[model samples]
Target: MTKAPVTPLLDRVHTPDDLRKLPKSELRQLADELRTEMIDAVGSTGGHLGSGLGVVELTVAIHYIFNTPDDRLIWDVGHQAYPHKILTGRRDRIRTLRQGGGLSGFTKRAESEYDPFGAAHSSTSISAGLGFAVANKLAGTPGKAIAVIGDGAMSAGMAYEAMNNAEQAGNRLIVILNDNDMSIAPPVGGLSSYLARLVSSGRFLGLRDLAKKFAKRLPAPLQVAARKTDEYARGMAMGGTLFEELGFYYVGPIDGHDLDQLIPVLENVRDAAEGPCLIHVITQKGKGYGPAEEAADKYHGVQKFDVITGEQKKSAGGPPSYTNVFAKSLLSEAEQDNTICAITAAMPTGTGLDKFAAAFPERHFDVGIAEQHAVTFAAGLAAQGMRPFCAIYSTFLQRAFDQVVHDVAIQNLPVRFAIDRAGLVGADGATHAGSFDVTYLATLPNMVVMAAADEAELVHMVHTAAKYDSGPIAFRYPRGNGTGVELPETPQQLEIGKGRMVRGDEKQGRKVAILSLGTRLAESLKAADQLEAKGLSTSVADMRFAKPLDSALIRKLMATHEVIITVEEGSIGGLGAHVLTLASDEGLIDAGLKIRTLRLPDLFQDQDTPDKQYDEAGLNAPQIVDTVLSALRHNSAGVEEARA
Candidate 1:
């Protein structure tokens, strides 16, 4: 059993101001309590437990050394900010984490003053930290700015872009590389292994600076002879000088868990840093807890669990999630065809491609958190006549928008895009929500956009995408479980741009219709049922394709129905926007009819359960019914008032 932490010093810390009053000796005890508190709090709420646990000592050391709020400390990806948040006056509200109207799961500028730069995505810290550093420099302020990023996030080209620019410009900036050897899963590519080797050898700083000093201080005649000898000697001792060549003064391979080693180096670097610096601190991902340390990826994000047993609390099971279904379907496809291959940007498990990777090892590629490279690489495979499917979360795919446009769309490559989490992703909040994929992808020439109405349709769409070798085709699915519809074993191909009418009674004069896109079909059908009981006939259509919309079905529905409502699981520039565009072009608005679009509201959604968020956005069945009734009431009153 784990011993209870000493807590007297912790009770005194209400804020960072209070923390400053404590002596360095008491701060050590306080760090112990902070770790205990984090463990206890996350045990109840069950969020990003492993990341917070890994950074407890680092958090305490940073706060103890630097005067924050004034000193801008940016956290890359924000998963490791739980300990920081608890330390900075959010301790009492820790229980309300990821709940509706409570503490956010990730860093938010609006949530706290200490979180100066908000982040939910990886590899953004370097650029954001540079911005703050530049702003401080321009303002003639003498404040320190530091960016703490992980090795996994370092794979992204944007981080390298920021590092390249910072080194060239020779700005006085600090970048802490939190090396954990894992990013949800073990990191891929040679760069990851190279960094691992550099850290493992433990002579990065000694050899690097010694070589520099030897090269600079040598006589002119002897310099050329010494340079080659030093290069050979350096290679024998440490690995390549990638970061140094990029313009950073590299330091460390230090133990992140040990405060003694970390604090002194940080203090020295903080005082002596004149140009851009990279301090690589090696740490275990799930440092404190045994279960988490053993299964780092599983504990990265978890449901409520028993702290003692480390077993997840069961919440009633129903249908398999869309992710699971997609994984099975993709695996099934690759089983039959040898040419089909799968790829993801550091999310083999998240995108449900782990099974595919296992079934066909030769056909699977797990590119380290580099979305831009993933897309262009997929295009290269397609160019060479290989069927490549690039499956990525909708939010992450936004990182490769330019590549998707320039590389894939321009070339008209037959790249299949499986865009998972393509709606308001609950709990993870705005940064992880997949809102803009439909609008962005739909606008591209020769690009096909699709949304799955149910799990069966998702299987069909996957098959359709695999078979179609014309151009780039994308199919988006929501974050959670399917609607319990029985999936088909034999996959069927769907027409590129057709909409299916699910439920309706258009013969009667009570002609009001709800047009649904994607998973909202079930809720729309439920609303139609409620409307029918209230002596109003409602027609519901499930629009599978967003890009090439079924003009025939839409035209038929509009002509028959008095009121037309467009509902979607996504945002304003999505299904609703596409329907409006179609209606305007067909001159249906001038033909004496009422049309309104119902989508996710135009505001950043907060952390909540998926059902609660859908209800909050008026996308649930009861909420949809209320919206339709309100529209009908206004339409009826307008007719009555105009006659009067």
Candidate 2:
């Protein structure tokens, strides 16, 4: 259990090419150093740790055996690709992971040739790898597409879809099922390793093919029996019947931590020419770290931590997160109604519904990595007169858009969509950013979209969504702690198309109006304060609902104010677009009233602090002030002169 003070072997290798040059005997030492390096780097940077730790040896084995950059290795979800990143010429930048202007937390094609396909979402690697493999085959090229996908990702239907069509790629496609969590086939030991190596070996494969030829020449009924016998024997030993049925040549249940098993089995698969192969490798999450191994989720996602004690940096006590507020509020609602239930697409803790699950196990459904199914399942529940809350991240909900449209919105099913992480998420970057939910969901018919300005607002929204039974209702909240506002003693039901005013109305010279949505209310208020000081009367309205457009409030603002602006923490076609449409529809723009919309820039923003991201998106207080000043046709100094 002693850690190395230096990564001597790892220091000499900058890329997988360098790694491939090392002797097979030295690989174990190299793997040990790689593990230490990943641990040290993640401990400093604070990102996905446990999954990366589990894959250290498996990563080393893949890079060592395959001719990568040409071989095309894709990691499913890519949170587990840190060690892969370190081995593939990104070791020096490993410490900069998930930071602004630094390496991405997931696999990105722009970052390195080693990452052939960019992936942050689960169950995509196999599909992407199949494309690469089929491309190489069609081009008559010299490469294989290797997909290292975890078992958690395999619960999704896409992996099997890719496998069913993998026969076209011949031996060019290889799937390494990284069995780290929710193991599909949990048998891994000496026997498993032996069988894995034996099945994948040249001699065993040669004999099987020879037996197949003999069996094909037999009588039709006997040939069927022979094929069944051969398949069942391997299936009984390796537990690969499912994959084999999907047209994959299956190997393993091999110990992933053992370099000896991984390297040889990978080598056998590499040399084989008959396969669209799958190698099942079992590994432990948080493999090399003691504290991580001892904890649940295995320190899956973490803040910066001490390498020695494995203690993460504690947060200075602050307000409860919006997620927590939502969980508690939903739990309270559930207590009142027996028919109310909750569902998450394998994101119990992230959505803060783990506590809800604990409280009402019978009503909670964790629909393992299948967002498509989760939405439809909730619709089914709602159709039967149960109030079902389907809590999911905005980014993930994109996967179930069809179901949202067909099953919920079209049918007018009463399903509540508790959307968490509804804006630009900080460290997880553009892929995980929940930027499009408002834009996409708002456009759908029979859909009501609301965004919480703060924790208190989230509580009210949750209650409102629960009460709403006419159609699909979705409420969005951001990904951080609340604004520390006092919660209402009892949650209130907000009127569907109404908004509340926060600051000045028609009193002080009647000039500017700022319509705020989501968590940008604080910034809008600050902008109003700045505008007031600059001799411009400003009104701040929290337009809580993104859909239905608060027609009364918006029309009133347009009538009273000369200049109007809309601000929201979403992409181009969100609150701003809707407000502009409302103004256009009413022919209010023809009356010489100038209107501008402030929203997230029309681009995918990278990872950074929430404040920096907002600033970059031009949705901050300063930006809001700038938008108003420009609309009024006055510079800061000019505004002062006008006031004087």
**In candidate 2, what are the lDDT values of residues 417-482, reduced to their tens digit?**
999999888999999999999999999998999999999999999999999998999999999899
Predicted model with the maximum lDDT: 2
Looking at candidate 2, the ten consecutive residues that score lowest on lDDT are 502-511
**Candidates' TM-scores?**
0.90, 0.98
Per-model C-alpha lDDT, please?
0.81, 0.90
Model 1 TM-score?
Answer: 0.90
Candidate 1 regions off by >4 Å? Answer: 1-6, 168-171, 182-240, 505-510, 633-644
Looking at model 2, the pairs that clash are: none
**Candidate 1 lDDT over residue span 15-104, tens digit each:** 788887877667667777887788777778878988888888888878877789788889998989998998899988988888888898
Candidate 1, clashing residue pairs? none
